[model samples]
Target: MACNITKLPLFRSISSRSFASAANPKPIGGVCDYEVENSTVNGVLVTSAENNSPITRVSIVYRAGSRQESSDNQGVSHVLRLCAGLTTKSASQFMITRNIQQVGASLHCTLDRETISYTLEGTRKAVEQVLPFLSTVATEHTFRPWEVADIVGRLRLELATRPPQFRTVDLLHKAAYRTGLGNSLFIAKYNIGKIGPETLQHFVNCNLTADKATVVGLGVDHKELTYIVEKIKFPELAGQPINPSPYKGGEIRCDKGGDLAYVAIAGEGAGHNNMKEAAACAVLQKIFGTGSSVPYALDHGMLRSSIKVTDSFAISGLNANYADTGLVGAMFVAPSNVAGQITENVVDILKNGKVTDEWVSKGKNQLKAAVLLASENGKSVVRKLGQTGALTGSGISPNQYINLVESVSTQDVNNVLQKLGRNLSISSFGNLTCVPYLADLK
Candidate 1:
């Protein structure tokens, strides 16, 4: 049963009750009571929200990512993000971890294709005390010589332990873009020794700038949070300025190891603001690749002998939609012998295109259910809000998402499929033995 926090008078009076109930109940679909304040920290866009709740979350998102790096600096952005937690002006990595544990908080950073986010979550009281430390790390981290060497050593260890096939994904991106937004992963086994303290420091200095930053805060009193934010100071942003842009699409393929061939075909689709098109693209993915209950199967009849083919592979398809551009693709991991046939069949399905009214309705319902489930947690809510605010400069309510999904129709799905069918970029990652068949997609 869904707990209606909005309907309860007790919850209305006690802000903490709303957070306590959020874990189990579906999120309330209305405007958040918190007020947002926007400012610039030496040109960085900082957004903060104040609420009466005890827990608070602070996130700093930057535009610098793997996509932004030049070929020579392919992995620098990722490396910088990882090293952000290691050394700060006020504390060492050990002290930061200890302090966070004592306060029941956590600090971490994540790097994606287009963005790097540093996040901290804890009690409001704790966060108020901790914000300065976080700011120092964000704005003034010092990459010591010893720490740089240690980080490189650890990265080398990871590369040695990981399988060769795993690296092919990075290679695929490198080949596809060939330039902007298509660089290699940081800390490759082949490149660890090449990176040193000077290069890492240069990377940090060049990429960590106000022009590329976005700060988001949730669950703290807005007035108090605003005060804290206003008091903090940052040096003037340096380096070349960055503006948001969409990723251009092109083919990228890699041949590595294993008896089976893995293929991922992708194309540019829609953005967050294009709700109808995004929903349509999702429905297109469901009808073509999602084997769940829809009973769609790969051409080679599951290819049981292939190592990459698991129960999960049968239902897998890529439906990643972003703020500026999106990727819609289908992948199949099948035996080397049948890999060509599977790719052809998958393409055939895309070309034949059968998006009926029933299929459209089912996809919409499934997508809505998934969104509802994801929005139930307070952390998830904050993350969603942060992404929306950062990417679109607007906040979306849960009800708005539901309404948008429900509004999609069969014609929209068919339209999306028709567009994807005509223009597509396919990528494959696997063995050299499987390379010949990949050219067939062209």
Candidate 2:
């Protein structure tokens, strides 16, 4: 029986409430609630959000990701990410871990195609205790050869456990952009030993510059963070700017032995600068749905429902926004024999898909809910603030962002769908005979 929650919040309660009244009601992101400040400490950019929480999150985000790496230095960024919190010039790896644990703080590193971040989360006092340590981790690192060797072994194991779908998206980027954004986040097995400490150091010296890095703090005082940031010195970005690589539509296939095939079909969509289009693409993603929200079930989205059988298959929408370009499409995983049928159906739906007012409204509401929920998490807010600063030099409130999503009409979604199909790029792995080619998609 369907529960009637007409009067409750669409997301918080199990309701079939109409979103027309709620749509564009107010700005929902709430990032603007905090007093945001931006300053340059000795050439390093610092963006802070004084959220007034006892706990604080400090992140050092740099533009030195895979996109900055060249053919010779491939996988250097991955190695650098592993080296975070390791031995620095003034501290040993053991000492670093012990100190953070003693202070009851959490420290970790995260990387994407365009950026790498090292974050520390704890009480304000604990964060203060580790600011200098984080600075060392971000800049004054001593990449010893033995430590680099150890990290390489761990990276190989990490790469091995990833599902074939993850590798497929990596290949999709390679086919879409060829290089730059095309570079894979996971290092190739052969490049493991090849990425030495010297190469990592060179990559750091050239990319981790004061100009390319941002120190972002959430739930911390702006003045205090600025004072701490002023004392740390970082190398300048001495490398020449990387040339822009446009999206070159194509396909890449790997015949890894497996019973199921993993496929991702995509084309250029919206860049980060075009947030309206990005938001529209996100609504499309939610409308298409990604697999199932419930365990042992499948979504009723167009692609999922169109499939006659699914015990052997899984498919989802793929929408990713980047600094200058984006990818919008679908991913499919199915038994080798049935993969072709599933892929064909999904592509057909995407090419000629129709978006209704109901789907658009639901998608906007869901996207708004996700943005609000992420804001409730301190770490997520920190990352959001950092990304805003890095990309747009400012932040938007959750409420404002919600309105952006709410404003996406069915027409916007249809336009984005048409754009995605205009120039398709297909990436397939595992069993090959069942996945469709770019020509087949056309």
lDDT for each candidate structure:
0.58, 0.75
lDDT of 1 at 44: 58
Over the stretch 24-89, how does candidate 2's per-residue lDDT look in tens digits?
A: 312223233555678878766788766556667788887667888899988888888887877787
- Top model by TM-score, which number? 2
The TM-score values for the models, in the order shown, are: 0.77, 0.87
Candidate 1: segments with Cα more than 4 A from true spot: 1-55, 160-172, 238-253, 272-275, 289-315, 431-436
Which candidate leads in lDDT?
2
Tens-place lDDT digits, model 1, residues 322-356 = 66666666766666666665666666656555666
Which 10 consecutive residues of model 2 have the lowest summed lDDT?
A: 1-10
